[model samples]
Target chain A: MRWKLIIDPVGRPGRDNMGLDSALLRSVQEGGPGSGGDAFLRLYRWDPSCLSFGRNEPATSRYDVEKIRALGLDTVRRPTGGRAVWHDAELTYAVAAPCHAFGSLRQTYLAIHQMLAGAFERLGVTTTLASRRSGRAPRPSAGACFALSAGGEIVVDDRKLVGSAQVRIGKAFLQHGSVLLENGQDVVSGVTMGTIPRVCATSLGEVLGRSIAFEEVARAIALEVRERWSGSWSEESRSPETIESDKFGDVSWTWRR
Target chain B: MSNIPDELRYTEEHEYVRSESDGVVTIGITDYAQGELGDIVYVDLPDVGTEVAKMDVFGTIEAVKAVSELFSPLTGEVVDINTALDGNPSLINQHPYEDGWMIKLRVQNLATIEELMSATDYAQHIGE
Candidate 1:
């Protein structure tokens, strides 16, 4: 009844963090296309800031290259699609497993969102799912994924807290997302004019009227995940070999748009 | 034309067309198109009153995998573009045949409709 759980606190540079994400997804996909029912959980953060765009979303659509370079933000592309996101003052996660493990894609997405929502709720922070409107009309912000609330994204008082995107290969599915616990406007400002909408984001400190330790949030997520999923938790650190050969080590892989 | 609906005309890109009372043809992407695109994320459309020629790229649908252009089935002026797609871009993924309808085209030339797919021909063409 218990699923295997991996809680990795990979705090590294933007390049390495992104690389690890890619490496983990590739390994999980190759492990068995997820049909064998095994799942892996990863928790990570970026030291320096970075910008990520989803697959099929042209990098030229939003990112302002010179400005990002000027701000020293690492730029990369993700296997998922939506819009660009600035990675800073945020903890990101990627959950990989077989498609059937979570049933349909929609169900799988909600299950994870609900897990995060529950964690936030436990902290007494009010949260809700984004209201979905149907139509081809353009939204206000076409730049950052979090700037616009789509169905299933976690939002607090009309502002996004967590924004997730997914890429499914055959039966194996890889989902990546970020949670804001601090101000990342400086990182977001590096993108371009009109790309990053001024979304009001609150950290655990702001929500509780006092500061919440980052380690505490991380521990809560790990503990809650173990309890809820009925699994034993282990903190596994990514190896240098894995980081070099697998992640952030190659620009070609990260830029695979 | 193998999988094409007989009552509905087809565009070369495989969209199905059904004529309406106002001389507009209701358009929706064929099953084959959606199946190939994978799970759709965003659906785009040209504004109303836009004129399009046959096979013109009028809109696009972004799937989890990639983005595919939605082509016009015939030369026409767009009468109405589906607005429900703003929040519900997944409609094309859920019900491409029913609620997923994309746009209404006011026939610029009724003859252009004749070039589209026939149900019988489309069925055989798509190997349905």
Candidate 2:
């Protein structure tokens, strides 16, 4: 099989969510059992809502740390790079596998986005992939991830719909992103420090003209996954070799940049 | 086709190593790597005096599409990093071999560099 499906529908804390994704990425990198054939598509949600920073995003200097705490928002830094994303009321998906599973880094990114676009289509929501910008792009220094869409990102009504990021290590890589079920990214702009750009974003409910649930979105994605890859999807537990992540939950790691 | 300079040696991970002196060698991603990564937005490298093992991640390069680890090709201590990338990471997309050079290391074993892929070997490695 080219893919394995791990649907963790229950919400968990930000640290543990990021930790599982990081550990799964390492499992695919090291190459042993339970690594999934070519990829592991783990779909999950966040508990109590969380704000995640890109691995290198300057959160300590730009984000209102005190405000985030006071708001009771769980936070963690993703191993992948992009910008800050408010992971709330969303269906987050992580794909971890060998780099060659898709192809070159750029190809891998676009291919995954294509799968996501197809999934959205099954849910009757049409999406277009953003083109690569000619000049500058959104930097990791500040601003919300949904504030702008990079080339190859997924969009609807010309607003950013799915914000994704990737990180490559040796022979393997991990790419993950959020498919917002509700309009939650607005919270990001409120917490940023400087006068950052407002979020140009959309959500499944907004596009579908109704409220959307995580299960409906997950079903559409799972159907797309089945059609895209050969063989049946397996529901496997976490790989035993995956290391426990102390850093994902650590403040030092989150605020390291 | 991406240029593979004849004088440089390369790791399978796509990092190029250029001999700077007796024990010092400069490291950076190959033209092929920058091409694969697309427009670079930022570069994060280790500080001077940081020791790294061969194949260990010393830093990461963030492109518009992805962020990839920069693996150490030769085990050594960091001597310097390209601070120029702090402001204009596009230097990598513009001239990855020259202005985009990432790090300098005082190699623990100079002879190991000889084991790295030559330009001809790298061309084949990338299926050029």
On TM-score, the leading prediction is 2
The per-residue C-alpha lDDT of model 2 at residue A199 equals: 83
lDDT of 2 at A123: 88
Candidate 1 — which residues are off by over 4 angstroms? A1-4, A32-37, A137-141, A194-200, A230-257, B1-128
- Writing each residue's lDDT as its tens digit, candidate 2 over A1-257 gives 46778888478888888888888888888776766444689999999698999888889888889999898888899888888999888999999988877788878888889999999999899999987777755567748888877788899877998989898887889999998889888788888888877789999999999998998998898889788766557765443345445888889999997
TM-scores of the candidates, chain A only: 0.82, 0.94
For model 1, how does the per-residue alpha-carbon lDDT over A107-217 read when each residue is reduced to its tens digit? 777778888887777777778876554544232135556555666778877777887877665446677788877756445545656535655555556666766655666
Native A-B contacts reproduced, model 1:
0.04
Candidate 2, residues B4-114, lDDT tens digits: the string is 999999988999999997699999999999888887888989999999999989988898658888899999999999999998888888988999999999999999999
Best candidate per DockQ, number? Answer: 2
State TM-scores per candidate: 0.64, 0.92
The per-prediction CA RMSD against the true structure, in angstroms, equals 9.8, 2.3
Isolated chain B TM-score per model: 0.89, 0.98
- Model 2 misplaced stretches (Cα beyond 4 Å): A36-38, A236-245
